[model samples]
Target: MGVVNVTPDSFSDGGRWFEPEAAVEHGLRLLAEGADLLDVGGESTRPGAHRVSPDEERRRVLPVVADLVAAGAVVSVDTTRAAVAAEAVEAGAHVVNDVSGGLADPEMYRTVARTGAVYVAMHWRGPSDVMDGLARYDDVVAQVRDELAARVAEALGAGVAPEQLVLDPGLGFAKQGADNWPLLAHLDALTGLGRPVLVGASRKRFLGHLLADRDGVPAPPEGRDRATAAVSALAAAAGAWCVRVHDVPGSADAVRVAAAWRAARDVTTHGETSGAHHA
Candidate 1:
């Protein structure tokens, strides 16, 4: 997956693709860079970021999503509002990538179900402006796992088919640096939810902080693609269903390699099993 922020306040590429034409072009470019799916977000979910209204979010995302889908890209609308999601899907988005799961909107699940689009429910507590205080947990990984499971149940209760749902750990949402680390370390637990796991750790502040501590300082945003790709590769190896990233080509390449290695491992294990049985 590749991220295309169509908002003026996105943490990584804010204001870079806010214009409809420019955002559409960028989504096409990411598709060319081998993004299997394009995620278009109209709102900036960066910590302390102000919320964009559903009307504005729809206005920003619908046109871009329409263009991407028309051009044959699998488009996911990154939104929390049910109203925005319904409009985006009508405009051509095939997936609903809600960072707030369904907590932010009472009707989000029903909206997704009505659209029949794939729904990505990210672990979240509240709006980014106040999410930091919601990170209180004895075991962040387990807590996230449990919360995501409940979300799955909620979606089902809201009439969403089990096959149409995916889970995201929401790496930076309401999570402190320490919280983010443990979640990644136990990403398999999230995957064990019996749903596809989508992890977004690209250019996140916690990663920059981690690098700063390790190297005595950290590089700027431009220098974080490599780190993001590294994390992408790790997520792929851990069996992530998809990794939301900005560096599409690098992360796609990493996923391909990880997939090949996993295939090889499976083949070898099967061979060993056959040989042992014969012996």
Candidate 2:
């Protein structure tokens, strides 16, 4: 998945694609760069970002989704609003990547069920404006998994088919720097839920903090793509269904490498185990 935020205030590369024409053009460029799917968002969703009206979100995304779909890209509309999702699906979006899972909108699952769009339910405690305070957790990874199970139950209750749903751990949404590492290091727990995991860690503050300078300054957003691609490599090796990234080419390369490495490791381990058993 390649990210294209159509809102002006997203943490990275926001206003750069806020215009419909520019957004669609960028989508095409990412496609050429090896994005299997395009994720277009109208809201910022960065920490402390406020909500935009549903209508405005709709206005920002629908045209871009339509144009990108017309240009032959499989698109996912990154939104929490059922109305926007409904309209976007009607306009040709293949998936709905909701940051709030189904918590933000009562009708989201129903809209997805109605439209038959693939739904990505990200683990979230609240909207971006106050999500930081909601980050408390006894065990972040397990808690996220349990909470995601609840979201899955909610969607299942809302009549969505099991196969239509996917889960995301929402890496930097409500998480502090310390909280993120555990989740990424132990992503298998999330994948063990029997649902595919979608990781969106591209250009996040946590990566920047990890790569902080000697002066203690975090790496800048543009400078963090390599780190993001490294995360993609590990996540794919650990069985992520897909990784949402801004640097599509980097991640595309990383996952391919990780997949090959895993294949070789599996063969080596299986051979060693078989020889020992025969001995």
Candidate 3:
């Protein structure tokens, strides 16, 4: 999955694709770079970001979603509002990638259920402005897994089909830099919930901090793409359903390599088993 932030304040590439035409062109470029799908978000979910009005979000998002869909790309509207998700689906979006899971809006699950579009329920603690304070977790991975399971339950209870659901371990939403590492390390715990897992670790602060300078200054978001690509390779190898990324080509190549490596590993394992049986 490729990220298309249609907001003026996104932490990565803010305002670069804020216009509908630029956003659509960027989405098409990402598709050409091998993005399987595009995740278009209007609101900036970066830390300390404020909310945009529903009308403004719709205005910024709908045209881009419509144009991209017309161009034959599978698009996911990255939003928390039920109205936005519903309208984006109506405008031809195939997925509703809600970072707030179903916690942000009472109407979200019902709306998604009614639309029959794929729903990505990310594990979120709260809104972006206050989310940093909510990073208190006993065991980040287990907690995130359990919380995501609860969101899945909420989605199912709201009449959303199980297969229509996808899970994301909301990386930077409420997580401290250290919190993200365990979640990435224990992705199996998230995937163990019997849902397709979407890993959106692209150019996040955690990766920047991990690759910080000798003076301890964190790397800028754009500088984290290589690290992000490494995470993509590992996540894909660990059974991630998809990896959301800013630099589509790097991660695109990383995942393909991971897939080939996995295939070879499976072939080797099968051959070993056959030789053991013959012996």
Which residue runs does candidate 3 get wrong by more than 4 Å? Answer: 270-279
CA RMSD of all predictions? 2.3, 1.7, 1.7
Candidate 1 lDDT over 1-279, as tens digits, reads: 899999887778758999999998998999899999999998888899998777888888888899889999999999999988988888888899999899989999999889899999999999999999998999898999999999999999999999999999998899987889888888889888899999899988787876675656755665678888888888898999999998788888888888998888777876798999999
Q: What TM-score fits each model?
A: 0.94, 0.96, 0.97
Which of the numbered candidates is closest to the native, going by highest lDDT?
Answer: 3
Q: Who is ahead in lDDT, 2 or 3?
A: 3
**lDDT by residue for model 3 over 106-192, one digit each (tens)?**
999999999999999999999999999999988998889999999999889999999999999999879999999889999999989
Query: Quick one: how many clashes does candidate 2 have?
Result: 0
**Order of candidates by TM-score, top first?**
3, 2, 1
On TM-score, the leading prediction is 3
Clashes of each: 0, 0, 0
Candidate 1 stretches greater than 4 Å from native: 213-217, 270-279
lDDT of 2 at 3: 93
Candidate 2: what lDDT? 0.93
lDDT of 1 at 279: 100
